[model samples]
Target: MHPTTTNEPPQTLLDLITDVLSLLLLSTITVQSFIGRWQVLRTKLTSLQSSLSSLSESPLWSQNPLLHTLLPSLLSTLQRLLALSRQCSSTSSLPGGKLLFQSDLDIASSSLSNHLHDLDLLLRSGVLHHSNAIILSHPGPGSDKEDLVFFIHDLFTRLQVGGVEFKRKALESLLQILNTDKKSASLVVKEGNIGYLTGLLDFNDQPLIREQAVSAVSILAASNDESRKIIFEEGGLGHLLRILETGSMPLKEKAAIAIEAITGDPDNGWAISAYGGVSVLIEACRCGSQATQTHAVGAIRNVAGVEDIKMALAEEGVVPVIIHLIVSGSSAAQEKAANTIAILASSGGYFRDLIIQEKGLQRLMHLIQDLSSSDTIEHVLRAISSLSVSDSTAQVLSSSTALIIHLGEFIKHGNMTLQKISASLLANLSISDRNKRAIASCMGSLVKLMESPKPVGLQEAGALALVSLLTARWNKKELVRDEKSLMKVVQMLDPKYELIDKKFPVMLVNALLSGRSSGCRKRLLDAGACQHLQKLAEMEVSGAKKALQRLSGISLKSMFSRTWRE
Candidate 1:
């Protein structure tokens, strides 16, 4: 569903980030008494978190009666433990915190003990249980905990009196309403009704009720922290897994959507995988309807972003299932499937080798040849980019004329990331002498990309590709043919290129000046490239000075002092 793109780590990633941040927090904690409570609670929280993480290994963890009884109670404590132990500036807790939030770590670290009693109350409040009444987020009149009690009392009375069909409509309507707003979604999930909601999925004859349950849980998981945290704690994912295994067709589709939403956070991704979502999603993509396949692929995409989870998927042999979708599934399914493969392949080394060994690149190239929608193009470009990083994969891609030409067009112009990635692939493909012309076809785009804004790494890549293109006699003439093009090549020598200390671009400058074409030489001079060259020649740089001597000689040096200074 790609409702949004994110690279921000979930709470699970905090252990790593905190380890890095802990060195920073060390002196701060030592100076004040803040170390006392923080050290104790942090250690306890660590133990609790380790316990929770183990549960993510399998649903069998849930079947242990001792664990099943203890987990629900411990979850609230863990939630409050995590929440209270946070550095005051926790970006995860604070809105807009990821980009610009710094916490008063001293104060937050010191205050951990004060929350023990409050946490006890919060946990005793039964924050994870499922019930019938709707819990409203509004703190207005008749909306407090007492108000909820009365509503629940009244709701059960009506449910007992209402007939079966009437009961189904009431549950469906509540789910519909809850799905409408974060407020309602938050209330339902935080109030622990997700367990009750998932229980409805077991009514074999009531698919609508089951579908609504899946849809509502999807909404709740997507809403905000309260719902996300509480629902996930209550084994909401295990419930969804059950639905995927046994529900009717429409119910399966909704369940798939809900599973994707739940696993979108990396914290939940491992839990679902432990429950065997990797195999189920693979089967769903293979056998479900097009929409079901699409959503299932989307779920796979999210779960696979967790590096270990992706490794598990590869281990389960679903890489072939995903590759199969690129050729045999609907366009939407292919797009998500391609994206899923792209992320896995991007994990590098073993992942790339696995895809290549699976003949994944061949299928992806086939996708490029046969499919041309914007979405499909984006995914295939990403996929090929990952695969092409390998020398062997690069060799396969170089042989595909369709891929080179299509990618050249994309490199020349597309979305920011698409153009940058396309240029990178071209750089790799250009390693093969046979593929330089294909990349050369996109010179106009490459020239512009060298001037692209910060973080592109495009200039280095574009220059490297140009160096390869210039290896062929005509390509040097082709690039130098336009005076603006000649200058753009010269401009790449600016020392600001952070990739490789700008050495590759300097080698490119050397390539341009040392070329055999008199026309290219004259055009280089005409475009004031000698000014850039003389500047480099005078510097202590190795490649630039050697390149100048190879291109022109002491006569140009004489001209440099006379003409360049003026």
Candidate 2:
């Protein structure tokens, strides 16, 4: 230092002191910045912990009264704090990011568990007020899933024990649960809760609760068979029956659906009829709602499957009611009513005449003319098939050229189902000599339809009808066995009517074996009917052996008679 001379300049004490003070100031600034950040983070964590702890202890945390006042504000604050923590974590790659996320999740889970515990306690203690308080607090769009589940379980449990007050609360809670999840609504039904809920059917004082209970029971009944039986056992049928008798329009409508579910069991068809359920269901068809009327008709259809059940309903004037539903209700109602009538008419000629006498024919004609409803058209065609071919129907069909013309058009343009029905109706029309002549006038068109590329079912029906007319004694001389008609039948037997080809040969053998008409048997035998039948017999098809037996009889008889003459 002493040797260092003029080349090196010496530092002044003030300069050194200034440098030291500047270093201390920088250090202090650094320390203060870190302290401020740490304090902010620590404050956040403390606030979160306090909120978590206070979630259970504070009176505002209680769901009874204070929660209604504090829940909205608390949720908002929680959301804001979570957002701030997320933002802070994103800005820095510090260890606090993971810690903050875990803390948030843990706090949320703990809070949910605490709320559930509180609801459980309220339920166990039978304090519906507090339970409802918990529910009300959790209201609004963004409620917690786990909390909702817990609340519903508690409410249901309380409903199992509590009386009217708890029932009211539970019913309200059930509405919320049903609105939340259909599966949850189904779960309550699965747990035998339907029995307890349906017990409220006796409560006339609270129509709202009664309505809700009925709605719940109906939902349960629709899901499965067991719940449906529970509804019947718990007087649900009786309540619905009474409602159908006395309830307002809306109640009657719901009751109709409920009754359908209950009576839909095929096993209960007779029981339903015995309990006057059929009459009630038929009466419900008179209501304004098309849905109600449709359901009512469907129930009647179910019950009508049983003979005694149908008779009971018929005695109660079900046919007239269904005819009214068909004519006056909506198209859908008309379709359902027609379907039920078809089922009723399928029983026999008695219902057929009844349907026609009750102006069901007019209703069916209306449906047939309605192009808007394909279902209605289909059912109308079915009704036509179901009509009896008694003398009265034959007379009407013969007199009404419009009806025959309409049926002819259907035979041409309708679906396979409608075509089959039309074919059957034509067969019925051809049963009488007068109607046969009426149908014979359309033989050209009938032959065309029989040869069309439509379903074999319709063609088969048409062919049989034509065969009957052609084979009739009075018309046989006038009938033309042209080559084209014969070839069409042959083609029907070869490929299109494989399953029913055996019946074709049988019919031919029968017609030939009749022996009442001279030259008919020789004509059929000459037309390869014998060879075709012998070929079928070798294939071992049913009725083939009978055909062979018949052929053997003819040969043996001819041989014996020839020997006797010799």
Best by lDDT: 1
- Model 2, 235-321: lDDT tens per residue? 678777777667767777777788788888887667776666766776677653777787778778777779888888778788888
Query: Which predicted model would earn the best TM-score?
Result: 1
Go through the candidates in order and give the C-alpha RMSD of each one to the true structure. 20.7, 20.5
Residue 8 alpha-carbon offset, candidate 1, angstroms: 60
lDDT scores of the candidates, listed in order: 0.62, 0.59
lDDT agreement of model 2 with the native: 0.59
Off by over 4 Å in 2: 1-133, 136-152, 160-169, 176-186, 287-289, 348-353, 371-374, 431-462, 466-492, 495-498, 505-566
Model 1 regions more than 4 Å off: 1-169, 179-183, 190-192, 203-211, 348-350, 389-392, 430-435, 438-441, 491-505, 555-566
TM-score of 1: 0.65
**Clashes in model 2: which pairs?**
none
The global Cα lDDT (0 to 1) of model 1 is 0.62
